[model samples]
Target: MTALAAEAVRHDRELVARHAYGDPEAFDEVYARFSGLVFQIARRMSGDDALAEDLSQEIFLRIFRHLRGYQGRSSLKTWVYRVAINCCRSRLARRSRRERAFVAVEEGRLERVPSAAEGPQGRLRRREAAETVGRALNRLPLAFREAVVLRDVCGLSYEEIATVAGVRLGTVRSRIARGRDRLRLELERGSS
Candidate 1:
């Protein structure tokens, strides 16, 4: 492993130990270590950068508040993910009553379209395809999207995803399968 990887692993171990022993510095270290991951997950789930930032902060705050209740039943990383998913779910629930308005603005569009002068039309096509996939992901129901993101984007194993999602292992597999199927259909519609 690289020096950086080795250092990170060592730091994670030390921080976990110190936090378990009630060290405030260790809590700060944990926050710094996992905040980016939390933020990324939040952004993917909410599809809004501003809301994601707010949700990420709320997730970490909950983690700190509930740290004492952590029983080491799962890895700390998985537990952190569980908290993030719950935070995203709560945010989605609270917003469900409001109609989501999408503004038709140029800046909101993904920068995938190329100028007519660009010779590599294929590259532009690929970017458009990727943007389509992103849009389809954003449209999926929160539960399905969470499963897809956790299993595919974050590359978590099925067992880990099940634990983090608080679902049975079989349910995690089923949801991932169904989510992929739905996304594929959406992509096909977009392409046609």
Candidate 2:
């Protein structure tokens, strides 16, 4: 790791140690650092604003409750993401595939307020593109979807994804490749 990265890992360890020791401000610091990342991952993975909000809360609750067991085996960011992804996967697994599909379909119907700068046509185009991507992601197998979303949406390194997903590095690469291929096919089918 670079000097900066090593510093970050050390800092993460100290923060976790503080939180585990009941430092009043440590958890708040943790929340301030990770809340946006957690929420964005939830939103992109779940594709529903309201559900994302709920998942964000649940993720933090899990983080708050389980903060003590964190051994600092990985970067705190990686550990937190692992927890967030696992939580999302569990919630999604409980719903029937048909239910997930229905929700994904319904997601496209929700409206958003457009930026004044974008104008109506720009807003329409942006919405359509987002729907297309979301639909394609939803159609992907869980493993592939998780890998692709982690890599593309969450911007994690390949090694980081392998750690978070508990898979081999090769497995992560294969999943991302296959997932992108499937996503490309889906988008092409949609466009044509």
Q: How does candidate 2 fare on TM-score?
A: 0.82
Superposed on all Cα atoms, the candidates' RMSDs to the truth, in angstroms, are: 5.5, 4.6
Give one digit per residue, the lDDT tens place, for model 1 in 1-192: 578756755655666667778899988877887888899899888877898889988999898888766765555688899999999998886774453454223224433333335576867776766666666677677889999999887899998898899999989989999999988876555444
Q: Candidate 2: which stretches are off by over 4 Å?
A: 97-128
Tell me the lDDT of model 1 at 171.
91
TM-score attained by model 1: 0.78
**TM-score of every model?**
0.78, 0.82
Global CA lDDT of candidate 1, please?
0.78
Best by lDDT: 2
